[model samples]
Target: TGINYEVVALMAIKTELQDHYNVLDNWDINSVDPCSWRMVTCSSDGYVSALGLPSQRLSGKLSPGIGNLTRLQSVLLQNNAISGTIPSTIGRLGMLQTLDMSDNHLTGSIPTSLGDLKNLNYLKLNNNSLSGVLPESLATINGLALVDLSFNNLSGPVPKISARTFSIAGNSMICGVKSGVQPQQSMSRSHRIAIICGATVGSVAFVAIMVGMLLWWRHRRNQQIFFDVNDQYDPEVCLGHLKKYTFKELRASTNNFNSKNILGEGGYGIVYKGFLRDGSIVAVKRLKDYNAVGGEVQFQTEVEVISLAVHRNLLRLIGFCTTECERLLVYPYMPNGSVASQLREHINGKPALDWSRRKMIALGTARGLLYLHEQCDPKIIHRDVKASNVLLDEYFEAIVGDFGLAKLLDHQETHVTTAVRGTVGHIAPEYLSTGQSSEKTDVFGFGVLLVELITGQKALDFGRLANQKGGVLDLVKKLHQEKQLNMMVDKDLGSNYDRVELEEMVQVALLCTQYYPSHRPRMSEVIRMLEGDGLAEKWEASQNVDTPKSVSSELLPLKFTDFAGADESSVGLEAMELSGPR
Candidate 1:
C-alpha cells in the first residue's frame, strides 16, 4: 500500500504541511505523480525535491503526505496559520536539509523525526506556540548552524549547539547558558564567587588556597548521580538522619570506581557495581558531563525527586555522593540482574526466567508503575520503562528503575514531558505522534514487555533467523490472520504449557499493543485482565486466556469510517457491502 520511495516522500511532506495548514479538503491525488500539483517542487530529472508553500492560509490536520517528498531538500512553509502537529512521516525525509516553518501558528511538541535530518543546517521554528523541551536528538546533528527557537513556550535547560547558532530569545520559560538566562548556571557562578571571595588569597597562601578550594569543590559539587539518600536530609538543617557519603568514600568502595564494577551504561552516565561496608552490594551510577545546557539541572532535579520515592516494588535508593566533577548513585543490587540479561543468556548457563516467572515480573512491574501513577501524592510517570531497566531480585520480582526522566503529574491528569527520550520499539504510538508522555506510555512499554516475555524475542526484531519475517507481535498477528496461532507459540513451551493460558496472555498483550494509546488498556485494567478477567470474568482463565470479549462500546469504537466505502451512504450497493457485519 506504500507509494514509490520518492512519491511517498513527497506525499508525506505535502500531507504534513497540509495538515499543519488545514488544507486537506478533497485532497485526492491518488497517483504517485506529485509534479502535477500546484504546491509541489521538482528537479530537472523529475525527481521530487523541495516544497515551498509560504502563507497559503492552509488549514487542516497534517497528513502522512510528507513521506511523499523523497528527494525533498527544503520545506519552506513559513507564515501559515497551520495548527496541528508535524507528522511522524516527516522523519522519513532522509535528504531534508532546511526546514522553515517559522511564524506559523503550529502548535504541539517538536517531532523526534526532525532529529533524523542529519544534513539539516537550517531549522526555523521561531514565533510558534511550540511548548516542551527541545529534542536532544537534534543535538546529534553537530553540523546544524542555524536554529531559531525564539518566542516559543519552550521550557527546560537548553543544549549547546556546535555552530553556536542556537537562539532562544522570546521563549519565557526556556533556560540554558547559551540562551543566556539559566538560573541554575547563574546560581553556580554566584556560588563560585562566594567561595573564591570568602576563601581569600596571598602569594604564599595562594598555592595553599587554590589546592584547598580545588579539593573542597571536588567534594561539594554533586553530579546527578543515582538516588543518594543522604542528599534528602541536611542534618544541620533537617530533623531526620540521611545516609550520606563523600565522593572519596564512594570511590574507595568501588576501587576508585573501576570498570570491573560497572552495572550498566545510561543516557547521561555509567552505573557501576559496588559493595557497602555493611556486607550489602549496590549499583552506583556516575553521570557523564555531556553538553551542560540540559545536563546539570536535569541531574540535580533527578537526584532530588528519586530519593523521596518509597514503594516496595520501586528500586530503593541506598545513597548518593556529589563531588565537583563526580556524581554517583548507590542502589541495592539485584542478584539475577536485568530482565534483558535473562532473556539473552542460554538457559543452561544462566536459567532463562521461565514463562511463569516472566508473568509475575510483568504483573509486579505494572503494580509498581500503577503505584507511581495512581497512588503517589503527585502521580509520577516513569517515562523510561523497559526490560533492561526492570531489575530482577533473586525471586524474579521486577523493580522499575531510572528516575532521571521520571515526571510528577498533577492528580488524575496525565503527565506530559517535552523531549521524547525512550528506547525504540517500546515508545508508545501517541508519544511518537504528539510527544505526549503519560502513564499510558509506560503501559505501552509494559505491553511490549509482555510480548517479549511470551516470544523470547526483541520487540522490533524481524527474527529472520528464527524463520519469522516480522516482530513477535507481527508474527502473532500474521498467525492469527492465517489461522495458525497454535503453531506460533515458542518452541520451548511444548506440552508443559497450557494452550488456553498462553492464548489469554496473548490476547491481553495484543490489547496493550493497540495503535492508539487511548485504545490500550490502563495498567489497572491490564492487571485485572491478567490476574482474573474482572472486566468480563466470563473469559476462560486458562493459560491460553483465549476469550475475545464482545465488542462493547468500551472495548472497541467501531464507526462507519473504519471500514472501506461505508461512509458513502448514497452509494447503495457498495455502502451495503461495506456496512455488513464484520
Candidate 2:
C-alpha cells in the first residue's frame, strides 16, 4: 500500500508538468513501480530516491505531491521553463541532500519550510524571479555546503551563513550596508559649485589626452586586433567543476603539441593527446584561425553551449585553455578512437568493429543527436555529423565529439544561416545551395553516417567506386530496389549480419537523406523506427509519396577541391576534400 501511494503521488506530479518532446512517454501508469520510468531512480529496496530531468524544456507547476517521495535524496530540475512557487511540502524530504531548480520562470519567495531539511548540503535557486528577503532559517542548516540565490529579485540584508560558498550577486535591491552605519553630511553650495567646475575642466582635458592616445595606439597596431579584450574574461569558465588551465600547463602536457602525439586534424583545429600533471590522459584541441574576426566569438559560444549540454553519449568537456595567441579545449581521451578509424583501419589483420557493434553505434549516435535537437534548452545543430566525429569509449560506447561547426537554435526559430561548412558528401543539398541549416540538415548527415556504418566505407570513396553520376546515395537506392543489398554489405561482415535489420537500416537511411528536408524524420522519430516500433508505417507512407529526383542530381555539379591557400594538413578531418560547384 505504501508503494502504491508513491506511484499515485508520482502520477499526480507527472500530470502537472508538460513533456514537450515525449520524453516522459514511457512513464506508464500500469507499471508495478515508478522506478522503471525514464527519469526516476530508486534505492535498493525499490523506493524512489532521485528525480533528474534537466534542460528538458519542461513547463507547468511542480506538484506538491513530490513531497511524498520521502526517500528522494536529490532533485535536479534546472534549465527549464517550470514556474510557480516551490512546494512547501518538499521540506518533508528529510533525506534530501541536493535541490536545484535554477534557470526557470519560477516566481515566489523562498519557502521557510526549506529549513526543515536538516540533511540538505546544496541549494541552488538562481536565475529566477524569486523575491522577498533571504530566509533566516537557511543560515541554521549546519550541513549546508553551498547556497546560490543569484540573479533574482531577492532583497534585504543577507544573513550570516556557514556555507563554504554563498552568492547574492545580481540582486540589485540587496542591502550590503550593516546596521548602525552613519550617513554622510551634505556639502555647502559654494563648495559643490567649485567642485563641479573643477571636475568639468578636468574631464575635458582627460578626454582630449585619451583621444590622442587612442589614435596613436590604433596607428601603431594597424587594426590587427580582432577580438574584444573583454571576450577573454568569462566568469563561467572558472565556475562549477570546469577548470581553466594556463597555456603553459597545456603546452607542457602535450610536449608543446608534438606531431607524434596528434590524434586527429580538422579544418577548425588539431587534436593532440596530452598527459596531465595529475596523471590523467586528455585530448587537447587547438583551434586554428584564432585571429579571424569571429574566431573567439565561436570559441566562447562553443564553451558555453557544450558546458550546459550534459549527457553520457555526448563528449564531456574536461576543461579549456585560452590565451592571446592560443585557444584550446580539453576532453577525456577515447581509447577506441573514432568510428571512422575503426571502420577504415584494422587491428591484428581483423576488423575492429563487428556487425553488432555497428548497429549499437547507430542507435547511440541517434539518441545523442535527439538530445541535442529536442531536449536541450537551445536546440543544437551539428553541421558536421560523420563517422570521424563519432568517437568510441573504452566500452565501445559511441560518444559524439567535435562541436566546431555546431550552432544553437532558439526554440522559437526553425533554422539558421551561415557560411557553407561540413564534409563534401555529407552536406545536405538544401544547406549546400541556400547556406541555411536546421535539425533536418543533421538528419541528412546522419543518413550518410548510417550508410558509412552499413558498408564500412567512406561515402566519397564508395561514390567514386560506383562510377555513378548520382553519387553513393543513388547507388544505395539502386541496390535496395534490385534486392542486391547483400552485394553492398561490408566485405568484413562476411554474411554475419541480420538481413531484416539491414533492410530496415537501409530504409531509414533513405528516408533521412531525402532531397526535400521536409521529408526527413526528426531524430526522435528515427530512433523509434530504428528500434522496430514504426519503420513499416513510415516506410509505406514514404513509398506512397512521389519519389524525388536523385539526391545529387537535384544540386549543382560538385567537384572535390582543396580550400584556396589552406594548408592540406590543417584541413578538417571530415572536410579534407571539400566540394565546390563546378
Candidate 3:
C-alpha cells in the first residue's frame, strides 16, 4: 500500500527530532493524513502550510525530507536545542514566507540554497552556532522584509542584502577589513635601536606637516558646520532607537536625490527609493521648507517621540538625516506600496487587492490607528488618515506610515493648528473650517478610506467620474440606504465577496463618517464593529439622531475638479494648509 508523500515526509521529520515533552506523540506514521497532527497546519487542500514547533523542548537534527513539503509557507522552530546542519534541501520550499530558527544550538555553515526562497518575507537565524561566509545570494531576494543573523559564529564580510531591515551586529568575525600578508620577522635589538633613532629625527618633521594640514581641515570644517541645521548637535546623541545618518550617506544612497529615484511626492516633500551600502532597501523622505527655528535639540526631541511610538502596524523609523538646507526621514521600503496605489493599479491583468486582502487591510489599518490614538503614551492623533498613508508590507499587512510627521513638521505648534494639514476630500469638516483637529478628524478620514477600499477609487476622482452631486460619501450613503450597495462595490471583486460582510462594512463606514464628530465611534469601538460586534446598535443609534444644523451647513463640499489632473495612483496627496474653504 502506497503512503501519502506529505505523511512520509512529516514522519521523517518526526523521526529525526527528539521531542522530550511528547509534543509529537500524536504524529503517527500509520495515519494517512498529517494535517490533524499538533504543531502542523494545513491548507484546505490538505497540504501542510505551516509547521510551528517553537519552544517545544525538541532536540536533534532537522531531516532533509522537510523539503518534500513544498507548499509550506512558514517554518518556526526557534528556541530549542536542535543540532546539526540545516538541510540544504529546505531551499525547495519555494512558497516559504517566514523561516525562524533563532535561539538554537544549530551548527555548520548556513546553506547557500536558502537564497532561493524568492517569496520569503522574514528570515531569522540569529543566536545560533552557524559559521562560514554569508551567502551573496541572500542579498538578492527582493521580497525579504527583515533578516537577522546576529550572535552567530559566522565570519567573512557581510553581504549587502536587499531586505528593509538587516542585522549582523553580534558577529564579531564579520568585518569590512580584508586580510593581507604579514610583515617579516622582527629586527635585532641593535638594528631596532638604529631605526628608532632615525625615526626620531623624522618625527619632528612629520608632526610639523600634520599640524598645518589639521589647521587647514579645521578651517574648512568650521565653515561647513556654519551651514548645518543641527550645528550644536552631537551625532552620538541617542535619538531614542533611531540611527542618525549623515547627509553624505543619504546623498549617496538616493543618488544625490535623483529625480529618477523618486517614489512619491507629498506636500511636505518628495520621497525617493534608496539602497544603502549594506544593500538594504529604504525610502528616504526629503522634507521641503523645514523650519530651522526648532533648533537641533527640539528636532531631536520631536523625532525621539515619534520613534518611541512603535507598533507592528505602524511604519518603523529606520533612521533620519538633517542638513543645513534639508530634512529627511528614512523608513523601510514597502514592497507592495500603499493601499491607494494598490487600489488604483492592477497586477497580472487584475486588481492588486482582492476582496479578502481588502478586508484584511481595513482591519489592520484600524488596529494601527487604535495604537496611535489610545495605546501610545501621549495619544498620537494621525491628523491624516487615508488609503495613501496606509502602506502594505511584503505579506500585504497594513502599516500606518507618517503618523507623527505632521507634529514633526509643525514642532512649535499644538495638535490644534491654525494651518490645517491634510488631503482635500479626506479632511474632516470641523478641521477644514476651524483648523482644530482631534482624533475624530482621523476617524472621518478612516471612514473615507473604508469607502476607497470598497470602491477601488479615489474619493474625489470617484465623485468626478460618476458626476455624483454629493460626492463619494453621499453617493455611498444614498446607495446604501436604497439597498443597492451591490452597485457600489469594486467591479474587480466580481462575485468573490460575501454579500453580508459587504453590507456590514458599508454600515460601519457610514457610522464613522457621520456629520457630527461626537457620533463617530472610537478606534477601539471601530475594531469591535469590524470584528462583527455591536455595529448594528451603533448604526441604529446614529440614525435616530438628526444632523446638527450648526455644523451641517458649514460642512465643506468634497468635490475638487482642480485635483483631477493629479495622478490617481500617486502614493500620497500634497498636504494642503487650509485657512478656510477654497
Q: Highest lDDT: which candidate?
A: 2
| Winner by TM-score | 2
RMSD list, candidates in order? 23.1, 7.2, 12.5
The local lDDT score (0 to 100) that residue 437 gets in candidate 1 is 68
**Model 1 over residues 328-370: C-alpha lDDT tens digits?**
6778888888887787666654337766887788777876776
Q: How should the candidates be ordered by TM-score, best one leading? A: 2, 3, 1
When sorted by lDDT, best at the front, the candidate numbers are 2, 3, 1
User: Between 2 and 3, whose TM-score is larger?
Assistant: 2
**Which regions in candidate 3 have their CA more than 4 angstroms from the true location?**
1-236, 408-415, 548-582
- Mind giving the per-residue lDDT tens digits that candidate 2 earns over 1-582? 434877878888789999888778878777777864666656536788767787888999999999998988768788889999999999899888778898999898998889888878668899999999877777778776568999999998777766757888999999873344544588789998998999999999999999998898667557556443323333333223456787778888999889999999876788999999999999998877665325565666566567555555688787887765678889999999999989977667667888889998998898778767865556788888899999999978888888634667886545745466677678787776667788999999999899999999887777666676676888999999999999778898888899999999999999999888888999978888888989999998898777566776543333433321132122222221223332
| 287: Cα error in model 2, Å | 0.4
Global Cα lDDT for candidate 2: 0.78
Deviation from native of the Cα of residue 125 in model 3, angstroms: 35
Q: In each prediction, how many residue pairs overlap at the backbone (N, C-alpha, C within less than 3 A)?
A: 47, 4, 0
lDDT (C-alpha) at residue 52 in model 1: 53
